[model samples]
Target: MNDVSYSLKVFKQIGLLKPVAPHRLLGAGLQLAKWGPGLPSGVNAAAKRFPKQTAIIDDAGEITWSELAGQVNQLTQALKERGVEPGDSIAVLSRNHRYMIVAIVAVMQAGGRVLMLNTMASRSQLGELARREDASLVIVDQEFLEVAQDVDRSLVVLGWADDDAPDDLPSVASLMAGQPTSAHAKPSRHGQIIIFTSGTTGLPKGARREEPKDLKPLIAFFGAIPYRGNSTVVIAAPLFHSWGLINFAFGLSTAPTYVLRRKFSPQQVLQDVERYRAEVLVVVPLMMQRMIDLDPAVVEKADVSSLRITASSGSALAGDLANRYMDLFTDSVYNFYGATETGWVTIASPTDLREAPGTAGRPPFRTTVKILDPDGREVPQGETGVIHVGNDMPFGGYTDGNTKSFAEGLMHSGDVGYFDEDGRLFVSGRDDDMIVSGGENVFPRELEDALIDHPDITDVVVTGVPDQTFGQVLAAYVVVRDGASLSEDDVKQYAKTHVARFAVPGRLMFLDELPRNPTGKVMKRELPDFE
Candidate 1:
């Protein structure tokens, strides 16, 4: 679509085309002018427009927009008063809660760079990353106080504390208590947000990104998914990941009521959706699988008919899993394909999922995708090659100074994929994941997809293992459905009929479950050795 038409569509979807009171518009414009359209500005505007409206629902309970804005402003002042300066890096180690949101926004408003730390990181890893990032302060929840203290005991600040929590470290509530709720002075420079990549393969790398100067990223996202303004959204994904972070920024503009939990529970997700009548549910693919895998009685008790859009990302969504989820719930699944470095490359809508299962839908506005061979030439249609993407909100490279491979103006996504005749993109697997066995090349995704199609198979992972004859042969680790039985011979027969002879696993193992990281990607390194 052209720029003019695309802008119109985005404006309509975000409710910008609707009539608004002149005072609210003026107030919002003033806040944007002062804060330069970051989270602080967004919160201030929402407070002006809908002070009584619910802003967030967490473990503590619901908080109104006005209350949230007040807390953010107070925290900003407190941080500034406590010696936080412009461009100072502040590490945040906490789960998804109101205080985590408040601490991040307050640091940004205070002109301190926000570094989001993974909650699953070990104490040593957290300390090493904090020292490497040169963080001036560390804000953490009570649960993670020891980790934060390991990073720097002198610079620790509590983000969330229980009623009986220790009074040693200054908490967000204590700092904001009796403090002025009025807006603080605007800083000379805006703060950058640093997000670490999922360290499934190696050590996590920090990807730095600043707030966009224009609305192109948001426009491109809304143009693809049907997210409306003033709706309720439940974010089940971890906020430290790029997928959840993007949704948080989207909420800033569209003003969605956010529902958050410290830990992910499928039953709790259903209950929250039904309680809030949330129109949007954000999660990783594993969370969706778990929700659908719940007991029939438990699933039937919740009324989730109100969910209109179930946004999924952070990993590949299997075709069979998508089909099962849509069959159980509304046909509202939207799978996103992208990485920390490339932003969003493609978005698969409900119709796209129905027609071309496992296919990443077409690129939205202002984003370009290309399939390029090793020689940096465009590959033919239906030819597998490295996926490259260009977008307005690309990351500013990794903090370690290494950059992704680039061709022309696009950055490599490190994944191999192809475009079908209908123009839909189907990701085959990681470019580095392909293995040659018995003089034939094979990708694990092809085998995994086939095995997951079986009625008794719940989950599966295929990897290349060492072999004396073939150099390397395929090994399959599978999880069977409860009350079902499948032997190695049964799986071998099924694979023999469904897949190529070379692609069949040389060895098979059955387990209760496949080990996965927090973002739902299979931990290939964690797979057990087959004797």
Candidate 2:
């Protein structure tokens, strides 16, 4: 056998193929090595194990494992030909598509950093991010090409039947030609990926992921859960987000058939699950509620039989909403109490979902979580405190002088919450977002949850508004259900019954809709002033 083939065989025989205990490894003993970021190696392994199996399926087309590897190699060569080299940051501003995945892998293979820009982000915002990172190249689709037209960097326009291509833009496929696939790709650790915070509080800050020790815990946590390996996963969230990238990495390493949906629509999600026979789905709570809000006929029509696991992150999952989805799929929904800086610090599993619907599950293997007071002392169980996690947690401070954000070693989640007797973490609202009225501490999430209980309330954001007498009073910006009209008095009355009186919004503004960022997170900073 050739040298590469012989090495791979030796690696597999030693039990590197599967994540198992050292003693459990099979053939050759190579001292159980961890697989770091090596796209070529990953592609090689996937090709060796499942050459005929589908690697990625998107609107553009389906690619088998073999094809996927070849394309990545070709793309890597193409990128190198264009002067893109190791350690260069390449910003990708495009929607979810097969090419996006191929591009990401290829960038990694070429030892280039992948800075994923939200396609939903405004052109100016995209340009600012690219400029801030000093990105070497920008890959954009037709829809967003206009946004990057002014970006002072080389561009690879992903054609999407637009009116006309720019003078210098080249067809994406044509870029790859006679690339050397045999060249050894740099390790995953050699490349870094920066995920910027979704700035609801202020301007976004970049969080650079360096060191394999910095990301393995996160990537490993996803691999350990959801019924072990050899499971199919569905990507409903945008690839740019932490949740999306985690699932994507897990899918790549586990060799799971990853099914991608270009954009999330309730109907589209149902159709994709049925079409791909997906065993797993990564969905946010809002998306779940949207599906639940649909007619029962729609739920009955979508065949979700292949689903084995439903994972929820990026936001809290309401008990009723969690129960509703669990009933629909007969699969428990898992939630992780995590942030962009730290990944899966604590996660609630299927059983946890059924029993403790609101609690984000227990800490994953080899992860330590501490609920601490402001002074950093560990708080007793059931006492609300900030969630502090460590796995060499990656909030090495924001690039924009936000070092105060990370206290000691833990990335101060800024969220307040408590652990139950079972050690499950329940997240409260952000420390800043908490509402204080008449000296009573009130979490807006609790108020928002109670408000959602009302049939007419479609969406609501509770904030502490300026109050002359009370310093700051509870206020709410509510989006009423379509065709239903309600006054602040009605909402106040409804909330009084469900939540504490002080927690009720003393001031309320009825809005057509709440301002949301690209990921559906309510932009509380944009809320107008209300008495």
Candidate 3:
């Protein structure tokens, strides 16, 4: 068998499908070595397979594998000349564009670490994160370069790969010229990428990738299946996120062509799909909603016939929205569920999505999941409890000193869910967000869903507040529809009939807009603490 097939066979034999049977399963004794050098590892292979095929497309331009390889060579030389050595952290802050791909390859090719800075971050926040990561170099576009002036790192100005730059900052294009194409280094799987979670949690902790063993499954599973060679993928989200990292790695593992946009615009998405003839698209629920909100003719006018699959992750896909998407697009819509701590643990296929709207689908093909009680004991199949996923199949653990996130052998997903008779997983809410009022346990999602059903409410969030008598009381923060006035009584009356009496929100506050993190997750902590 070939090397890849042999590696896959080894993975399967190690019980990639099931947990290690405590009584009989002994750990595999073989230690496998990854062959090949740094950025060239996958790029070299891709170039050989599809030298003339377009590998990346953006508003700026399109690049084939051969051209991409040459760009990587030139940029690597430029970065090396600027004193960026192997293992140095290269901070990248830019919207999704062609240069983003070029800088990433240049960093990895030079054996440097990539620290993706959130483009949506405030100037102060970006500076703080860059300082916290202690990045040695930063590459940014002309628009964001002003924000990086006080970042305390060397800067490389991009968006002008072909021009001569002033003072210290060098143009990205000038550096790529005249550089030798063969200089390369091998990247250790143990290398780290610090990806901040896209959730509403403030002061987000950077998730580290450490285990060499855990890295392969991410490559094998996501690489081969979701991201196959010669496929076209449309990425509308920011590339500095876990989703973006996964997209990059998938391209590296397999040689799929990718198209990126500076910012997500529903109309632009359709235009890119039609223009690039994209075969697959990965998006979050919010972006999909925006795309649906566009004129019906937008979908009809756009030629998305090349689209084969659309994977939605990062948030729940409402039943109504899912059906509407299927009706509008020819491609299948799948749901993916996982956290930064655990890479894509479960996936709901289009069939599963249609059969069960809110279900996050079955555990991934090579991962195992269990619903456990508060005490860590496995709950009955139908019981709602925290979901724990085991990482026996070359899975990486968190970087925190507390390795105890896993109990016995499972990684606690911090989510409340249960399995149905058909073994489909249904996530109800987050355990941390469950509001306990008086003696009743109230889940905010249930209340939020009920609130959104009201015509006046355009967006709503449910949170717990300290109450003198009830210990914790339920409160709802809402953003009303334009020109519509909604009173507290209206909220209460709507919730009372639609939701349980005890679950109805006691206090209602109206705001021009709901506070959300860059990824659109509601910031519950920012909500007023009421009694």
Candidate 4:
């Protein structure tokens, strides 16, 4: 098989499927026989091959491949009936649930580009994002109904409503019920999934990617990470973020038994892993920490031994967290470093983590990693600089024309890090997250890494809080372990021992938990003003 054809085959493996309809399965067979690069076509292949396999197990319900394909078909037709033409933008705002997955797949199946909206998006951000994009239709969940109240009712679709109440907004369930569960017209080409950045600095820009031209890099990633091909998988990360969405997309290609929980609860994740016998567990750093926070007895009893891979991304996976999780869960943690604009830059396996506790391992196949200084010159090994990624896969540039500058032939990653002597990449901090403390440039990660080792601390986010003396002084927001107690003086003294005095946070505040985006990145702007 050629690259594209092989890629189509990989797409067929997208999670597991089961029988729901014989005729529809036959149709799926026909669709696969005339396979294209579209995701629906992949789903069709899986529906035919794994007709009796379980596809999705979510809070909404369990579904066989037959049921999933039928739902996608129904929604595809419903969307077309609603005047959603191929290539039109369809936005989705919901948590991690079956309907959210359905809306995403159906939109693309209908040849519409799916724009995933962050569930935590504020009303103004939603309005602005919807208005700025070419989205004429938005599929929103009931929890965010109030946020989408102003959307044209004709273009609005309720994705997941708890009560299934009759309302002006058209319902996804109603559409699926009214439409037939079978194949629809072939989608226009599977357009890029437009994921928006967290936009901590400004408006979130869409990082679009065309259909991957080459499958080698992806294949290498699969080979490198212990994903346990074609096994039961549990994804706790929100699909809105790049890390989660990539896994979700890849899982669809592999057709595994996909278990999703709409909201994340530490204990519940362990339960799902045990119940589903999930071999591949995907999480963000925060979720991993939360899972570790569960009672030791509860964790020990939870049978997560089926897990072959516990991949994490979207934020720095602290060395302490990695070691603790590995100690508890048998060294299955894999940490990745990258951004929304650029795909995976590096992936650190358990061995890499064990060797260099926080190293973001070397690049996989067909990927180039470079750390360049302000002058665009490659920085010396082990010197902090902006990260740039060069992969054969085309980055479907931002929709708003705000693209990052390319160094040589690579896209700038906006992360400040350097490669280790052994060629492993390590991210120190974000390019813009640096602060000046007493005339010295300080990266929050310096202090964060220093404090993450403290047993009393659960999680920490260090940000630049303004100070008259230093222009920008360091501030830290910390979450303590259950029943742990520590004073400001205690933390300050501990900070003094680990990092330079200038890097020590001048202000420290304790909280039950830090404010984090769905992807687990701490929202620095949301940090409390303790001064």
Alpha-carbon deviation at 95 in model 3, angstroms? 1.5
On lDDT, the candidate that comes out on top is: 1
TM-score versus the correct structure, for each prediction: 0.97, 0.88, 0.85, 0.91
Model 4 ranges with Cα > 4 A deviation? 1-38, 188-190
Task: Compose the digit string of candidate 3's lDDT tens values, residues 161-190.
Answer: 333344566657667778877645554432
lDDT of 2 by residue, 1-531 (tens): 553564444334323466644442321121113335444455556655566778877776688877777777787788887888788988877666667777877887777878877655776788788778878888887777668767863555563324476556764565665665554445444656677778777667787655344334533355335443555677787788777777776455466677776767888888888988888887777787787777789889888988877777777665456776778765757776688877667877778778876667788755778888988888999999888877644555555556535555666777888899988888887887776678888878888878876888877777777787777777788898988989878988888898887887878898998887656687777788762
lDDT of each: 0.88, 0.70, 0.68, 0.79
TM-score, candidate number 1: 0.97
Model 1 alpha-carbon drift over 4 Å, by segment? none
Ranking by TM-score: 1, 4, 2, 3
lDDT of 4 by residue, 1-531 (tens): 565664444343432234437775576567655534346666776677676788889987788887887888898888888888878998899888878877888887777788888888888888788888878898898888788766666777888887755467677888888788866766556545898888765678887866555345456456457454458888898888888877876555466788888888989888888888888888989888887878899988988888878989888887578888988886788887777777888888899998888888889756788889898899888888999998755678899876778988888887889888899988888888898778898999989988988989988888888888888888888888888899999999999999998998888889998887888777767777874
How many clashing residue pairs are found in candidate 2?
4
Candidate 3 RMSD to the real structure = 7.0
* Model 2 lDDT, full chain set: 0.70
Candidate 1 lDDT, tens digit per residue, 428-469?
899988999989988888888889888899899988888999
